[model samples]
Structures are given as C-alpha cells and as structure tokens.
Target: MSLKIALFGITRDIVGTSVIELPAPAPATVGELLAEMRRQYPALGELRSCAVAVNNEYANADQPLHTVDEIALIPPVAGG
Candidate 1:
C-alpha cells in the first residue's frame, strides 16, 4: 500500500517537500511508518519531537494505518 503523508513545519523542510509517498504493507502501524521515515530521512530523527496524525486525529504508535488514510507528520514547535 502507498500512503501519502503531509509534512508540516520543520518536517517539510527536512523532507524538502510538502507531501511524501511511503510504500508499506497492508495495515502498517504508526510505529512502523515512523521507523521507515527515520530510515528514509535521517534528519527527521533529529527533531526534538514529532507527532503522527491520521485522518486529522493524533494516532498512537500501535495504531493501524490504512491505504486511504490521510497521514501527516508534525514536527516540534517552539514559542516564546
């Protein structure tokens, strides 16, 4: 299955794109996707923190991923 991930903030900068296409097996987990992201874009691993969202809702590490899901990578944010 091919998942399209929307990138935000520093994630977009690190990935150099607004969207990314990740190929994974059926029913991939959030953890698995994250591991693959770190492998494909090591810079993403440098962030202080990152969050994954599916269908506009925050997802847990064990959450299952679907091919039609709308995934997003949200990097850490700092404000004074």
Candidate 2:
C-alpha cells in the first residue's frame, strides 16, 4: 500500500522535502514503516529517536497504519 508521509522538524531538512510517498507492506505499523523509511533514506538515521503521528495525532510505533494515511515525522524540538 502507498501512504503519504509528511516531514516535520529536522526530518524535513534531511529528506530535502516536506512530503514523500512510500509503499508499505500490508497491515503496516508505524514501526514497520519507520524501518522501511530508514532503509530507503539512510540519511534519516536520526529517525530512530523521532516521534510519529498519524493524521495529526500521535501514534505509537506498534499502531497499525491504514493505506493512504497521513504520517508525519516529528523530531524533538530544540531552540534557544
């Protein structure tokens, strides 16, 4: 299944875009998707410590993601 992914925080810079498309296995979970993302974008290594959100709501790594779901990568905030 294909899903739309949104990048926030530092993830956007790493990906060089605010959005991307990804194909995930059936019955995909946030964790599974993340793993695939890491495989696809080795530069996204920092994703290991990032948070994930589905359709604007915080999601756990184990949460099952439906096809076409909007996923966002949210890294921890850092500022002065």
Candidate 1, lDDT over the whole model: 0.87
| Residue-level lDDT tens digits of model 1 in 30-70 | 98889989988999998898889999999999998888899
Tens digit per residue, CA lDDT, model 2, 6-41? 898678888889988775544388998777777877
lDDT of each: 0.87, 0.79
Which pairs of residues have clashing backbones in candidate 2? none
Model 1 vs truth, CA RMSD: 1.9
| Candidate 1 local Cα displacement, residue 65, angstroms | 0.4
Pairing residues by index, what is the TM-score of model 2? 0.78
